[model samples]
Target: MSEAPWWRGAVTYQIYPRSFMDTDGDGVGDLPGIIDRLDYVASLGVDAIWISPFFRSPMADFGYDIADYREVDPLFGNNDDFDHLLAKAHSLGLKVMIDQVLSHTSVEHAWFRQSRESRDNPKADWYVWADAREDGTPPNNWLSLFGGCAWQWEPRRGQYYLHNFLTSQPDLNYHNPDVRRAVLDEVKFWLDKGVDGLRLDAINFCFHDQQLRDNPPKPEDKRVGRGFSPDNPYAFQYHYYNNTRPENIAFLEDLRALMDQYHQVAAIGEISSEDSLATTAEYTRDGRLHMGYSFELLTDDFSAAYIRSTVQNLEAQMLEGWPCWAISNHDVARVLTRWGNGDASPQLANLLSAMVCSLRGSVCVYQGEELGLTEAEVPFEALQDPYGITFWPTFKGRDGCRTPMPWNNGINAGFSVGEPWLPVPAEHRALAVSLQESEPGSALHRFRAFMAWRRTQPALRLGDIRFLDTPEPVLAFTRRHGDETVLAAFNLSAQPVELPLDGIAGATPVNGHGLAQGTFADGRLSLPGHGALYARID
Candidate 1:
């Protein structure tokens, strides 16, 4: 297949800057550090890299709490360092996408700072602020994802400010036209800086109810993890008033308009809505966002039924929109441990890699995913994530997944000589990049080979996915592009499974990784546990 589109079927590597690779002696990974490692990232055969937030922040929610949108955080270096990274990545023929958190900003951001100073400040209405009730309670019953009430009482203004996350990360009043304009300006700044795209953080949270109305209680079974744990009271109520407002449509249109100005500059919005897949479809439809992904497949469930249901649901829900699928990200638990049984087998890792790429949408592979890294265990004393600290042991928030990327078996995994910001997993030493580089059958090597092979399949690249009627433990599907069809089948169980291939006959194996070898006869194929088979259908 000739290259269809820059984003169509392209694999994006998500790099959590603080944990990726530190070029300097500093504990944190900076833009210059990323520049130094661009060649390594490019060698993985990924089309692009999506760097997590490195914006100026107080590190309240790590870098998600943005203090400045146009400026790079000092810990990650200055503008020149970022420019150098962009240049180096482009030189390596890799597209660059920066994380843009438009939903909120750090309490220290100039706009929020001025807004909280007084009711009469020029930027007073910039953030979502409301007067407390006569009883001194918050204006609404909205809950924060980080825990407790979403509103934080600001004594200086004698009112509670809206914050869906940490109080330090106050929600922006997107209802205001000026706020929309300013956000668009921030997007333009990155596009002008030669960023090929943006990974919009919490894109669904950009708007809220205009009136200071209390959100209604959610029904007993309606709640699922958005950011807060189900045990937390924050998940008890419907988030109707706090986020995913109808007003967000226009803002998305505004965002899309700006992106359209530059050729091949794409925007992938992160739809963290209650019904994420539906919202993902809605957000990407009608030229709102180029593409968007939800948390449907990011959860702990690893089953053929769950995966098939999600893809089918999206196929049904999303018609004109494009989707981006990711099994692992910075915040979520690493997929290896999350989905892996006790063995933590390489066969399972290869299956996941193949499954993710075979989906119709674009794919995002996190930094250490190629190495099959599991979540690092962080003790309470060593906890760096404020979210994890707040709900210790019960939830133990995102820090487990944010550990330093293991580069080698050497001290600190070659991440930093000056002690890594977070401890590297001891179990990860054997799976380090240095060690994996030497092993041909390693997960890293499998990832490289799979991605290389994927580039050759038109059906896997831009075709539509059609599920075949197969029995339990077997997932059979066809990815078809015009007349070229690739029949892909996977045995998701630990025992052998025989799956029938009806109607279409004459299938031959293409020698995919970890698949059981068998000849096709009488329109049937035999597969072993954790096996996969790919063939070009005639």
Candidate 2:
């Protein structure tokens, strides 16, 4: 039999470079800092690490707005630093995946600069450009994810350019074959650098409809979204013509064909659309993307029914494709604060770690998640994110989630000697790595134990999941792989409860992971609040 891919059921730890650690007293985490901390990351037993954007940028979107793909931002380090980091991570038995923002580029990008100069420039058509209407309004009612119109007037070209995100992030015109080739070549540059994989950022937004049509108004009942506030105007539209164009499929195939040349190299696309689940399925099937993940699990909904339905729905649609699951990341609020009802206890943290890893797909554990870190309270004056500045008190921006990771209780939480880019919350300082290392019962140790235990369970790693029909607050599922079948259950509520083990027989409980309290007697299972169970059944 052929060997499975390294990412099939791997646990990938996400490191937000800007907030991870700072080694040069720059108050910003850089490549060398990551190199210094490789041992700590590998100690967690993750198969790989996905580092957020560190390419040259104007800091418009904090590295998402790329000005140069080949050059590493001087603030982070030079190309040599990246090369060293890559070599070190591989030596530690951990794969390194870097973010590739292909859909858009900073307005300052050479291509965008040349394209915006004139209608007859060599790179004139490299970006999306359209003439303004007679009324001098935008080309259409297309709204930017940041705010206002998606079209920005470029006086040099006498036309408006499309920007799905901030005005500084102008969307590239994939309709142009040269644009497609250029982007693919940039991706090849990274693949040649010995990186194991690429996390394609906003991969679905690569192609936009040629005909710039006004997006229809979204219905009131369907206005809720994962990252933005309800009052934000961007959520009022159906967003049909702006993004998720069919042309993306062919581009993905081209990308996959390029990746196939490298042994065991993978590509995972980030999909967000009106029907993100359907889009995720389409992107991952037919050798297009190695894997795909959407905002379904990243939302505010936290319940047994919601999680079960979300996974089952994706499984039903994704016939031959793999899915990646992440409950927290740089973009969303910390899962514990969002789902734990402001509870960041070690018990709840351990339960969440086991619960997510028990699912059918590969997993992404965000930075500081193992520490059970809560969202930092960044005051308005200290805010750095443009999204938060646009919608202040009404909706706090993502700054709360992007604060620097606390390493010690010393000044700046041991993140830096200088004033950090973002303030380190006092609450987070109390849960520092130094403090947790001494306590065996700390959330950090518990998470490490669970990940180690999970690696030994093939049923949990690479198996077919079958969710059991349990009560409201209890989630039960069985994973079957070859001759091994394991049953897993979790209590989602704060109150202890009893569950009847029906149709389950010849089971032996697995122990050693510091999970919450649970007991089984007389065919009945008694579970304490935030408890979890894993039993091998013959």
Candidate 3:
């Protein structure tokens, strides 16, 4: 048997630390809470767990704005708590991948603090700083992903610093060799502590256009940001100068060289750019990132053609690099609610899980996804996400998806004794883990069954995929590896569909998996609403 790396075709469960579980009665989940639920995570039969940021931060952008790379935030826990979580996860045969935000740091970060104090400081060039224009305007027309201008003025230095997301988070200058070395050293600290891998946050934004050129205005017809609403002005430009710079490739190469020293450690980058698919291909190619995932699949477009086109486009561009697929994550709304037209059904959730896993790459399943959780309704009063608050009513932001995970149908959904950071939706409580555990046909049970069975199928685990021509709402693909060929198909709509199975001969049905099994007869396959099938082609 070939010794493939552990991350290849692996399934990673994403745990948003703030909403996963809370044990300290502080209304916020912590490292100890994660450790307490290691058994529950392991029970899902996932290959790994990718924890979102828990590093020392001011919580400006929740944990994205890092105040210190080496220290754990008191809100999450201390370093010892992290060590214990890592050890416990490993003991359960689960690889642990922590989120690493390398592009920017919280303004409260010591490096940023010193850099902003004066121009001649030792760390003055550590961050991207520039003088204002002669007219006293920002250095360029760059816009922050959150809102307004990307430049934040610092009176102490009499200059403006670039902030792609929030003013509290200043973008670092990779042009400075010292900055690169320092960030790499911080990453090395985690590797030394035996982290299995890293899920690099905003990896493409590490290096900005040094010339401070203004980004060209995007055509009105092309104003759609990947994951943002059209109302946000950030989508009005091409974003060429602010992010996705060509210089980022070299830094990735340097980071990859450092990781190569460690045994079996991997890096997966999160790419969000004007052309994220192309950027994903570039970052993962040539010994940079082991894997790359974009927001292509996470968008609200839930059509068979869109999914096929996105995967095929990436496959064509990603020459020798691997791809990771995720339907939902911390930044986006829950897939069921987003794609189901407001109907969150067990069938839709189960079908999505199977469909994404059957694709030609590794996969990530967000927490609460197993229980068919929909997007929680966070009213304006309860809103905590700045992104949503900034664009209220028009775009409610990510807090709905980041609400506390429902463990039981009790007060606070058994997430915490005290109030949660975000309110748990009553609808989520209806589909709690406790309630689903007892029901054999629940989404949670079906998810576990499908994942367990997926591990046994080598073709699905690691195989070449070829999409078969099918009509609307029906997707068909075949996976083949070493004389083993498996055919998988799904109906991505609410109505039943009939598909003609051409070129498929003598296929043996695979059973006992809790998917909505479709029937094949007389060269015609009949699939019910949200139906799916997996078979071995003899």
Alpha carbon deviation, residue 64, candidate 2 (Å): 0.1
Rank the models by lDDT, top first. Answer: 3, 2, 1
What is candidate 1's lDDT per residue for 133-202, written digit by digit as tens? 8898888789988889998999899988999999889999998889899999988999998999999999
Each candidate's lDDT (Cα)?
0.85, 0.90, 0.92
Q: Give the per-residue lDDT digits (tens) of candidate 3, residues 370-404.
A: 99988888999999999999988889989999999
Give lDDT: candidate 2, residue 206: 92
Please provide, for model 2 over 96-180, each residue's C-alpha lDDT reduced to its tens digit, 9 standing for 90 to 100: 9999999999998999999998999899999999998999888899998887889999999889999999999999999999999
Question: Which structure is stronger by TM-score: 1 or 2?
Answer: 2
Candidate 3 lDDT: 0.92
Measured by lDDT, the strongest candidate is 3
The clash numbers for all candidates, in the given order, read: 0, 0, 0
- Candidate RMSDs in order: 1.5, 1.2, 1.0
Model 1: colliding residue pairs = none
